[model samples]
Target: MIALSLIPLYLVAVTLPLILAAIFGGPPRPFHQELASGLGILAFAIVLAEFVLSGRFKSVANRIGMDVTMRFHQLMARTALLFALVHPFLYQGSPSGGQRPWDPSRQLTLTTDLSALATGIAAYLLLPSLVLLSIYRTQLDYKYETWRLMHGISALLIALFLLHHTIYAGRYGAETPLTWLWVAMTAIAVGSLIYVYLIVPMKDKRQRWQVSAINRLSPRQWEVIVSPRGHSGLNYKAGQFVWLNIGHSPYSLHENPFSISSAPSSGPNVSFVIKELGDFTRSLHQVQPGTRAYLDGPYGSLTIEDRCEPGIVLVAGGVGIAPLLGIVREIRLTGDPRKVRLIYGNRTEEQILYADELADEDVTHVLTEPPQDWQGETGLIDAILLDLILPPVQVQDWLFVLCGPSAMMDTVEDYLIARGTPSGRILSERFEYD
Candidate 1:
């Protein structure tokens, strides 16, 4: 229900400016000028809303899933950029000058004031650069933190610039009510950043955690366990994730999101199965036990504890088994009667995690490169493998949870839907949407 409410809320926010303009606007300008103003208003509104859609807000992300929130953020940013790009072009043929004496409402002339035009021009150039850099961030040589800082600063600047441009140069923005609306919305947008960077960290300083243990699970994977120090522990459902900051200050940007591999029923200590991928992850081997850490979440909706489905199907690829492991442990620890099956896929047998723990469960392990004496199933978890492992009855009624590389998840989801599985029954979470 919370997720469904976001759509109408978003529509109202983006269209509110247009509605107010129509009510308070003194006169209707030419179609081109109105088009220019409407697009400009919408673009600014969307950019402001992007601040809340950064996937950091638990109220939004926790219910809808972080992956979906981030995808929406990306798509809307591009759309706003397109709207901003086309906004000025529609007013090209209009006469450019200061407000005329007879037309105090400025309906017949475009503002030629240098300061107002400068803000709009500056935003015009910076918005595109910001979007392009984000789209190709991985291709660049900068560190992730550096890129992140630059992105935030750039966005804030764009918001400020757009706010100034809208209030001073917009045909409808000079009205008192519309101006106040923009100010309030901009304040909320900027406050979201302050909340994320400063307020959240200040709160985390009290509820600290420490690395209790770190163990190499495989050649490329490691298990990190953190125990709460001053508090009881996190109150997260099994299969959720948290942003972990290790050996860094609570306010530091050196945090990374990882799924919890430990079940809530087990203990307060939370475990993460991390594979060496980014710079922070590559240094996991060197992290010492008892190092101070802070967690900023219990985010993501990749959980199954509340579901009424009679059976559960867990599909994992490589280290994507982290959250699924938590779910399996929860079921075993709590003695849940619902039947559970885990279809775990990896390149080799050695890459599999918690083999002994999962030995008793109905798990089908798939290996792309199995050893000569291997007895388990071989090849990727594609249509043929799924058909062999999952019977028709199970496919129709069971809840399917997936977390994996994008390609694997897409293949599994597409195949599952083709087999008549309802979309609502299949839940998935992705860390990398691109």
Candidate 2:
């Protein structure tokens, strides 16, 4: 993808100018500084381009093998921070080593430069703290909401600092001709943040769903159902997810995205069968019925639309079957004549998340530890089991949707590839946290 290619392009664009500037002199020529600033701006532009092209910011980060999308975002933020600091430091024509006051450059080092120094230091300190908060978010899970709020606050602070530093240090206020340019760029950055946070969330709240019921499926799993008010049905395709905010500020950063485990035809009432994998989800049992819940998605492209051939193979492990359940439900509702086969694996027969519902379907249950009187497939869902269940259809033609742990997906992918299946035909969604 172009996003992958742009990573190296950005690296070179940002680094090459600094390399050339350092070799020339203590302070490079005006043209060199312009070139470096131009490169920095270009790198930021590329990040925006990558984000637009990929649709989601996370895709670009995932393409580059970064653990999270926030890392790439913070990387761009820090780059901007550094550039803002350096512009004032390097361009200031100040004399060093306590030279004679008669020097023209020495006049620039007056104590009146305190504003520039203060703003630069503030920006420098705040940016890295924001980056650290983003990087170690999982470890600091208890303070995730606090960290998120602080992240936004710091962004505003950095923006203000950059505005002040640029206006004062660049003398843009005195230079009436360049005043508009300074105002425009600052407005664009600040405006973008507001649009992403405030405007978008307000527009999204109109798509809220009312909670119908929350049934405990197991000690660590739940089946949550929500009915849309009036004629506003939550129209989402199978395999897509929705962001859930349970009775709080709509702008609260505490919402989590979960795949819709029921079909859109399930009418006004949409369902999400969630597992208590984290702190946020572990408290799902406490949520009362008739509570307000905001839904903000139906994102993700893992669907059966790409599948054209007969005999579809759906492989799911643990609660990863949520999305696949929606797909199966849709297929059954539409009365499609296509033969569908589901291979579901779980740690134990009792621990199978949707054992009862799955038994009613044309699915083969594979449990690691079955009860004494149990009659079903055993052991892991490996190449041997796949080969045994695979019909006479060509491996290249059949589409396989694998959603589970990364290790299991990797194993399944390798097995499929070895059996002459093209990588494109095998679509997978990693439900586990990276």
Candidate 3:
């Protein structure tokens, strides 16, 4: 419902400026000119809204998944860039000069003021560059932190430039009421950045946690556990993830998201099944057990807390088992009668984590490359293997939760839906490398 309601809020936010402008605007210009101005207003509004959409606010993430939210952010940014780029070109035939004596508002002529025009030109060029750089971030060799800093800085620059160009140079925006409206919108957008970097970090200082233990889970994976200090741990449902920062200031960029492999019913301590991957995670095994840590979530919507399904089917590949471990463990610890099954896949036996604990559950372990005398499943978890394990009845009624490599997830989700399972019953988490 929260996700569904966002559509109207989004519509109101992006269209409010255009609506107010039409009501208070002067004589209507040519159709093409009006379209150009309208697109300009919409693009600015969208750019401002992007700040909140991508700000990691719980309000957005809790409804639509984080992957969906970020994907929407990327798509909308490209859209706004398109609108901004063409808005200037569409005003082709308009005469350009200083304010005319007959037309004090310059409705018949484009502004000749260099300062106002310069801001618009700068923003027009920088906006596309920013969008392209982000789309190719992982392809570039730069550090994620460096790319992140540059992305934030570039966005702020574009917002400031557009704000100046809109207020001093825009036809509808120059009015007293519309001027304050743009000011408030821009202020809210800028304030969201401060809220993310400064305000949230300050709030995290009070809910500090201490590392309780760190142990190797596999050759390339480790488990890090932390106990809340002076507070009950996060009240998150199983399968939710948190942004973890260890042995660093709350404001540090060292934080990364990891699913809580530990169940909330398991106590006040949280455990993460982290695979050694990234600059921050690679050094996780070296983190001391007594070091202080901070967390900023319980985000993601992969939990089964409110689902009415009678059974849960968890599919995981490699370290994607992190969240599924929490969900299955919660079902066990709480003695919930709802049926549970886990299909965990890995490249080799050595890559598997918690072999003993998982063996006790109804888990079907699959390996792409099996050893000489392997007795268990020995192929990838593809459609064939899924057919062999899950009966048609189970597929139709069970709630399927999946977390894995992109290909594995896509394959499994498609197979499940094709086998008569409801689309809503299938949940997936793409382990993005951000």
Candidate 4:
């Protein structure tokens, strides 16, 4: 909840320029021109703030969840673009040129300096390209890491150009105080970039981890475990995940986030349940034990801690059971006595993993395709299945933790909400959702 609580503070930091400009700005220009300047100022501030909303901040990702933070970053970029796009057209008939001798304050004339206007023109063109590339990232052929690098570099260039243009030509930014404030704000935003690229990697050098074991969990799923070399392991709650980098240096950009399937109560060794999906995931089988590993995480807000719910209902589909297994294992390890039910669904019987290892207390295993004489629940875990698992009176107080395909999650969430379950009681982590 740290990031959720800090949202108001984040808004204040980003809107400081607007607040200061409204108070200390010079005599108002024509309505259209003033509107143009105001919109430009707001856009620049929001663009700068997008750097910190990139899901690398522990204070943000750990509290609101990385999915929420990253989604906000993507959405805000488009909003800032709309503002920047409309700004120039609003200044249609404004007087423009070098500051006139008659108008010493330049209140009547907008600057037309080649250097200032050039930066703005370049930034205006680049901003939309950056936003479009991001929105259509998956539709393109480039690797995810390549897209990520391009996104960062393009953003940095845009910020630099916008800073130069804002200070040199902006009506409010021309003032010494507002100019300095923008400089400070831009520096802070860029500082976050430095922290993620340099500082975090340097810190990882002191606390390294190495792969201790790797084993196939199912046909397409593998389990990898790592132990801290010389220190205590992560202090993460169940249902959290980390960016795991194996056989790569701390500075390498070859990491992917995976849920920590092992419970914190299971000693210093942490485990991950990874399913073969992309380039890196498919190569999990080739990874050897004792490989150098680095972790940047324990991020995500999905957890059962401090909850007053009488029981927990875990709804998992196929490999999505990874995090829920951690919660179930932890609960059993501590013997907390809270009633827990697991509703696991898979397409075929062979897809199920850890079936014998799982506790049988209210466990409902559902398979869409079953062989002859196959006993147990069959078919999709939908309304019909939910009705059998959840008693109507118990739905309001039980915590529902869901992870699966977006369709399954949406259906389960809608059903829960429709049946009197409070929104807060239904927790989910949709990191790759977008």
Q: Write the per-residue lDDT of candidate 4 for residues 1-434, one digit (tens) a residue.
A: 56568889878987889888888887777889878988899899999999889888888777776667887887888889999999999988888899888987677988889998999999999999999998788788877778878888999999999999998888788888899999998998899999988899898878899999999988899999999998897899988888888998888778888889998898999998888977788998899999989988888877899998889999999888989999988998889879998999998888887888785667889999987787889988888889986788668788999987777888898899889898888888764623
In candidate 3, what are the lDDT values of residues 1-434, reduced to their tens digit?
56667889988998888888998888898888899999999999999999998737988887887767777888899899999999998999988888889987768887879999899999999999999998887788877668778888888999999989998788888877788888899999999899888999999999999999999878889999999999988889899999899999999877888999999999999999999877888888689988999999989998898789888899999999999999989999999999889999999989988889888888999998999988789888899999999988789899999998988998998898788898889888887633
TM-score of each predicted structure versus truth: 0.97, 0.70, 0.95, 0.94
Ten contiguous residues minimizing lDDT sum, candidate 3: 425-434
lDDT against true structure, model 4: 0.87
Per-prediction tally of clashes: 0, 0, 0, 0
All models, RMSD in angstroms:
1.3, 6.4, 1.7, 2.0
Query: Considering summed lDDT, which 10 consecutive residues are worst modelled in model 1?
Result: 425-434
Clashes of 2: 0
After superposition, candidate 4 runs with Cα above 4 Å error = 1-4, 368-374
Candidate 3 local accuracy as lDDT? Answer: 0.88
Give stretches of model 2 more than 4 Å off. Answer: 1-114, 117-121, 155-189, 204-208, 360-362, 368-394, 413-423, 432-434
What order do candidates take by TM-score, descending? 1, 3, 4, 2
Candidate with maximal TM-score: 1
